[model samples]
Target: MALIHCPSCAKRISDKAPFCPHCQFARTDDPESLERAARIRQIKHNQSLMTHSFIALFAFVGGFALWWWGGEAADGWRAPAGIGLMSAGFVGYLITRVRIVLAKRSKG
Candidate 1:
């Protein structure tokens, strides 16, 4: 069988194959299918970004709140706990930002 390129992923596949082995793109030559595949990928990427963003937001807010509440405590443990929470939140946010930048670079 002759090999053909899978438009969805630009991978080579046997012309007789029912679907692309790598990306699972169907063998159809329809333009809409390719567009649909791209759209699906984009939607998934957006969902991931949203999830990260929410997590980052929650972490930052929670950490700040903890720190604020802990500052009012007479015991020393609360201050340390608050600092740890804030540090964790900062780290999480940094990681998320890095991932976002990397993703954008890869996409470009």
Candidate 2:
């Protein structure tokens, strides 16, 4: 219910607005909430990446270990499976990157 200055454009506007009505700046008040939301989204996105990357890393490790230990499985098979894990990790990374870009655009 009080007036606030917009961080982006330095205009006076209502504090309740998530973005400044005048110049579309972020409201100074409750910036922590916004930051927190951003962080939460980032963590979730990164966690997803971690999951995918871990799967890939583990697959690679398992394949390497088996090969190193002289396992009977074909080298080509293990290589392809490792490649699959890396592809999954790459997909996850791309997803998170898109999400971050979208979020930044939305804030504008």
Candidate 3:
């Protein structure tokens, strides 16, 4: 039998199989069920992306607060450390947002 991708888990499986071995999703001729599974998966992925973005935003804010602490010129290590954290958080947040948009636009 030819190998096909499972609708639920996207794993390679035999086309003749009735269920996915990986995720145990039953394969059927019904388009509605397949579409439902795909939709659920997409929703879950979007939620995860949102969580990542939130964490990144929190980090960015925290870094800014740390850098701005006391208002006076940041002395030795704190300035550099805060700047580094801010850069990392900004990049992470941007990438996550891009991924979220792409995921939403994708059909499957």
Highest lDDT: give the candidate number: 3
- Candidate 1 per-residue C-alpha lDDT over 1-108 given as tens digits, one digit per residue, 9 for 90 to 100: 998777666678999999989988777768888778767776677679768877877777776787677456434666677677777777887888788788778877
Model 3 segments beyond 4 Å from truth? 70-73
Worst 10 residues of 3 by lDDT: 99-108
Residue lDDT tens for model 3, 7-95: 88788999999899899999997999999888877777788999999999988987888798898756688898788888889999999
For residue 67, what is the lDDT in candidate 3? 90
Q: What is the TM-score of each candidate against the true structure?
A: 0.60, 0.37, 0.80
Task: List runs of model 1 lying over 4 Å from the truth.
Answer: 1-27, 70-77
Q: Which of the two candidates, 1 or 2, achieves a greater TM-score against the reference?
A: 1
lDDT of 2 by residue, 27-79 (tens): 44477855765566556665765676566556556555544456554466655
CA lDDT for candidate 3: 0.87
Output the lDDT of residue 26, model 1: 74
Pairs of residues at least 3 apart in sequence or in different chains that clash in candidate 1: none
Candidates in order: C-alpha RMSD to true structure: 4.9, 10.3, 2.3
- Full-model lDDT for every candidate: 0.75, 0.60, 0.87
Error of 3 at 73 (Å): 4.5
What residue runs in model 2 are displaced by over 4 Å at the alpha carbon? 1-29, 66-108
**RMSD (CA, angstroms), candidate 1:** 4.9
